[model samples]
Target chain A: MGKNKKENRRNFLSMLGTAALGGAILSPVLSKAANTALSSNVTEIKNFEGRIEDFLGGDYTNIKLRMQDDVRRAMKKPAKERKWAMAIDLRKCVGCNACTVACISENALPPGIVYRPVIKDEIGTYPNVSKRNTPKPCMHCENPPCTDVCPVGATFKREDGIVVVDYEACIGCRYCMTACPYEHRMFDFGEHYSDGLPAVAAYDERPSFEYEKEWTRENKHDSPIGNVRKCTFCAHRLEEGLLPECVTTCIGGANYFGDLNDPDSVIAKVVSKLNVSVLKEEFGTEPKVFYIT
Target chain B: MKKIFYILWAVAFILGIIGVGMRLMYGHEPAAYGSRVVWGLWVAMYIYFIGLSAGAFLLSSLVYVFNIKIFEKVGKLALITALVTLICALLSIWFDLGHMWRAYEVITRPNLPSSMMAWMIWLYSAYFILLIFETLYAFRIDSGKYSGEELNRLKKRLKILASIGIPLAIAFHGGVGALFGVVSANPMWHSALTPIFFLVGAVASGSALFTAIFAFFWKNKDSEYFNQMIQILAKIVLVSVLFDLLLEWAELSIALWMGTPAHTAGYRAMLFGDYWYVFWIFHLLLGVIIPVWLLATKGKKPIAIGWASLLVALTFLGVRLNIVIPGLINPRVPGEALAYIHPRLSFHYFPSLMEWLVALFIFALGIGLFFIGNKIFKLTEDTENKAL
Candidate 1:
């Protein structure tokens, strides 16, 4: 029995040595073959057609790249023909708040004004606990209650379905703020994040490009200082053919944006295919922002 | 007593000037109302003063339109009170605006059809013009400046203006109620009864103010007619107070009965929240109970009725505060308040000192204007006796 075991061990070692040598000899050829196959796969991806859902089904990654292409494609259409929308996948969101910080930095938002806030709720008892993180942005509703309540037609919905406030026209009565069911609108109380400091930081006083206008906080009595502000879906960025700050900065790739008017767009496909819902559907606002639960 | 009152008014006026200076220099920096609780003490004061004006105007219509003989002596006084209080209301709202200079936009580029606010502005503009003309006509006829058909023509014109004013008062005040009611976002304010509730509140508080002023400051206190008028005004105030209480009960009880979190959250915050005493102590105890008891038991005594009406008039601000604040304290999205951390982003709200100072200034200014106008116009002159 001892002799047989020794012979088996020797045979196994010799086989292992032969296999290692053979693998080394064939490594370059195998690598070249793999590279060729990968190139062909890239070509296939580049030439990919059909629904976004189908594309994502094959490869769940590269969603941002796909949505970017969707944006570029939508930009070719006229402003009136394009409808901007956002879809957030709750499953993908880890609640890192990268999007929230990104939005503040992009807009130069003051202390009191927040365009997007991720609401984190912990449900159930300790053993069965689960968490939900919902990022609340302006719904940009089809039937916005805010626009209807502005005493001076200061706020209105654009043809492309973005609700914007004419900061100059806003008398700062904040009626629109109260009128919003989502409470998305915020009144700029002329506050600064660096208030009470010896000198306000340059970043705190930096101008935000909203509605394609440079709004500076140099004067407290200026337009945006007292005006009502909300998420315009980063309208200025859209005008420049770019995605919203939140969409681009979401580390989880949870946020998707595109033209809802285009049936081929990623957002449209996601909305139609997924079990999507809106915040406060009972209000009948018909929100453009959809949440994939 | 008059000396002490003057001293208090002087102090308030001085402090008010300082508050105005701070408001100008710092903008909204000193105000406590943040982005979440957007409207605060100023808004409450605005509605309070405006309700007083609307109520006073409507009551005066009883004299001018219905030609009620007993209230005739107080008609001009009521008009002057309405005008002064209207000015105070406008000032309160004007200070609350983000752009006080751009307020004219509501008139120039108004969204009239969809906006209840625009309708309010337009209606009030008409009411203001009508009020001015009505006051001028009533005073001119009382002055005996013209004789015969001209006098009759003036009286007829005054009657027409007052008649027009009745509907105008109702619409404007009811519009104010609709302003809050139409906000479907706030389950507390969104009610079909809000407009009616506002009208009732306006009448109750306004007549209470008129009662207190007449009881305390009538020119001829010893006149037998003065006692009768005081007793009658006390009865009007007592009924209106009870009615206002009924509406309050309906609003609170209905909301609390269902106990639906969405509908009852605001009421819960109002009745059992940190400032619960505002409803219980300030409004129910002082504004309603004490005033009701005094007006009911001592209805014939001018001094007692005066104190009761004064309590109702002053403490009614507690009612306004209850209405405006609780509607905003409960956020639509749960955990929204916790999601954002900033002083101004907070849901918790209490009016800052600056806000109270500004309000005090407005009140003092209104009183000063009333006295000045009374001196100039002899607002309480027994014009009927002199004319007869």
Candidate 2:
């Protein structure tokens, strides 16, 4: 009985070894086939020379798809080598604020903390008035004044030029909120939209995937609930080879996002070809966000 | 009168307890300060109490380091007041933190070189340690534990600590000023004069409080030396108040004259905004004019100087509020307040009742600690004269 058991074990081991060798030989070919299937639609968008106007006038889906492709390409480089940027074409924006809603939904943001807000202005007198909408996001400055004032070094600039707050480390002195030139940062006062409700909605209590960490607001004293939060260019989504929620949900195709270091990327082209201006440039913050007015 | 004070203290203490309970339970939900005008009464009170502590410590230094004989009687009392008020200041800012529990992170992992706030924390910690040692030595010498030579040795050590403390006090208080001053984003606070202004204000407010405490609380208030000390402290308060006003004038006049709207907006809001009375009524009328009048006209009378100094010390919070709030009233981006319309996003600010209660609690806690400490340590005892 012992001899028969050993012989059965040897037969099983030899079969497993044959299977491992065969799988190794076939793995590369199978992965290549899978890659082709995944990128079949993406490959059609190669060498796209589309301007902001063309993208707006033509199929808006193409621009989003092109940006998705740009994001996928940028993810190949190391974080330090890539510089993420956003450009808002002011001429194309309508005041729908879908991006704002998308961000709120994406981040599970509580009351009093807004990652983006669309600023509306009415120019000229009553008879000749024209309304303008400007969506404001964190500028993610090259020399971020907000990061410099943090007493605990809780908030800092990531190598990819996105500014993030370490919720665990932030003392939440609000010194950064005061120091921000654009006033982009918001303090989470640990409020809830469902405060007075009979039962808390599941959506209101959902966790946000910020900085690739699951931050569930189960307790008011938890990290993101009391920490200062701002836009991270939808960093977690970017890691999954997807565009920022604001960029994808922009109704008028107004927002552009890609790696600025890549000269051929859509954002790099839009920034260089257009006469773009940054808000509060005189402060010398050198904002990564640009606006094509 | 003492019964009335005790009743008030008890009431404030009870209310303050309720406020702290709400703060722990609700977080910042019950507070009014928000993203726009980020700081409110708590921050103002923090500077106010800290200024008092710094001011009191420096006055104590005059007795310990310089050996100013007329100031000798009130020296130990001044040290205890410093210690108590320093605790109050720490509590005020500690509760103001969003994650009050995580406050130790500032010590554990600090970003010193780039952040003015980090420098302020380090300096305050150092100053706090130096103060404890100095107070301990001063009290130990008077504890009747040591004889002639040992007492002299303790006195020498106290003097050495006091001397180290003078620079430490100046740096920490000035560092507080620079914490606000270095924010180039707020043109109002961004100035070379801010640190100097803080030091002067500290001396003014601190000396005024010392004078008041001496006038009202001294055991032998009827003594001739009491009158002499009060007179000298009144003079110090008067000169420092004028000096502080002079700095304020320079800061205001320069900004108002030939300055662009960006630079002048904060001063405009301060001098003539919704809460203009903070500057005009509370600060100018009560804090400056009335106090100055009493000190100048009734310089010789201890009772009159006490009232004047009390007025100055209490209303100096108006000055602190003016410094913190107006710099934040104007939007960094024009029309940003209208852009996002939440109660928390707006620029308008008034201290919520919870905030006031929390502030009251801190003040009561400080007073309570002072009474307890005084009882145990015989803080105001005439040990020095007995030794002499």
Candidate 3:
């Protein structure tokens, strides 16, 4: 309690400083304004302007240096602090793929491609059948089977416990797809976010030749294609200091996000209080996502 | 007469190049194969080629190791074909990867638990070195300059290396089969017979494809050596197919008759299900019944025999397609939609034009290289001119 109070005071102080500076200097990449408070206390905002100029090479005279400042501040927090994790309350989940939808909209995933899904099982049969839904994500496992068997290291668990893919490095062998037991992974197959896509909602909805899906669409290949993708735990959003879209938007309130390493974190507390169990526990994958049955 | 054939080869080569460029410009997703059907043409083609190589090597080993003089003429061609098919097989796997560049990391990382990782590194490397030495020994024996002592020394060494390949051939093809077999999630491919199935296909496809090449080249040329080799090859292909058929019946019968849920789910999806036509019509009839009948018939006309050989080669493709596709399309877990039950499934897919083109390029390259090997190593008995 005392440690949290101290940390809270420190966070409040920096939150004020960041607001005063209009968050221009700090990237706000840290989760929930907490880690940045502890680590970024030194180097006053005025001095940070120097760092920002060096980053921009003094050429941002017309534009607000705040943009670079935000990126820089984000860069300061360690990779661990940059990523936010989600914990699903399996008990709260009603087997509806609401989190799947939230993930689709948030990441602009291609059609038939989902970032996360609820695995439904009807254990037992006929008269006494009981249906249970196990919501699954990447698992972000420490000893990930997909990573172990990738042959290319395309899917690698980042230093901060978040598993990430260097899509460019991936060869589309989908070997990782086979290795994953939970079936949390999926291949892109050059598919796009089609069928029920909200194309109008996109900010910079250009043909992304880099990803190949958009290129296939622009060139109009019947295959909704390019590379391979699955749930990334909303990596881009985490880089910008936001709850994963699935966590924020889940109507069931089945999702919670916080640092698992931190004992007082909501996610940490949930696991501690609920005696969480990871799916395929015997697999020894050390999956970061904990489910409360 | 050979000059005219070269012109046709040049045209095919140009078209193959265009196909590769087209694949790069677009991508592989648009091909008429779904994610479940991911390893359709190219993967099957790869196994076909690998089978040919392994089969040819084993046949060549009979002459080298077992002192069989009757098959001497084909011994060298068999080794070279092995090299060509192996190269084609590697290309198929390379193109299938999600990130094409990091393929070498498989070699560097070396995860021992994964058999694919180990086979991916060892089999190709071992095959390459063996091929080089085998080619050298063949030419050394043919040169007529080497003394009896030197010939014996080289032959002894080649025999030792050749012995290693017999095991490698079984392990390599069996390992590839094991890759699919070990995936117990899909009961269709989960039996102990899966690897045995792959081995049988390797022998049948490998022997048949070799016969196809032999007949195509020997049709115009009067090479008694090649003709005799084809007769021997015909016997091999016919017998291998029977073993392959027996295994298929065993695998299917147990799955269908026993009536376990997993077996029933997989059998229904494959046998009397959506892929029923492919299973019964393509694999059972074309891959098995008809081709075996053609090879077994005693009608003995040369043109008729050549047709049978071509059919065997064509049927191998069907067998490979059936092996890879059936397991993938059927969801391992029943009661869920295709997406939900399938692990690591997202999109329903068929390979695009790009995928087909890249696969074509690989296939053409294999055939082209085989032709070149035939030219260089006296794969045919042409004395006037050689690839050198």
**Highest DockQ model number:** 1
* Residue B184, model 3, lDDT: 45
* CAPRI category for model 1: medium
- Candidate 3: which docking quality band? incorrect
RMSD of each: 9.5, 15.6, 13.2
True contacts kept of each: 0.83, 0.86, 0.29
Q: State in Å the error of residue B9, model 2.
A: 1.1
Q: Could you tell me which residue pairs clash in candidate 1?
A: none
Evaluated on chain B only, candidate 1 has a TM-score of: 0.98
**Chain A TM-score of prediction number 1:** 0.80
Model 3 chain B worst lDDT window (10 residues): B341-350
DockQ of 2: 0.58
Give the worst 10-residue stretch by lDDT in candidate 1 chain B.
Answer: B379-388
> Per-residue lDDT tens digits of candidate 3, residues A220-246?
223224455666666565555555677
Count backbone overlaps in model 2.
0
After best superposition, candidate 2 residue B342: deviation in angstroms?
Answer: 0.6
DockQ of each: 0.62, 0.58, 0.16
Chain B only: TM-score of model 3: 0.86
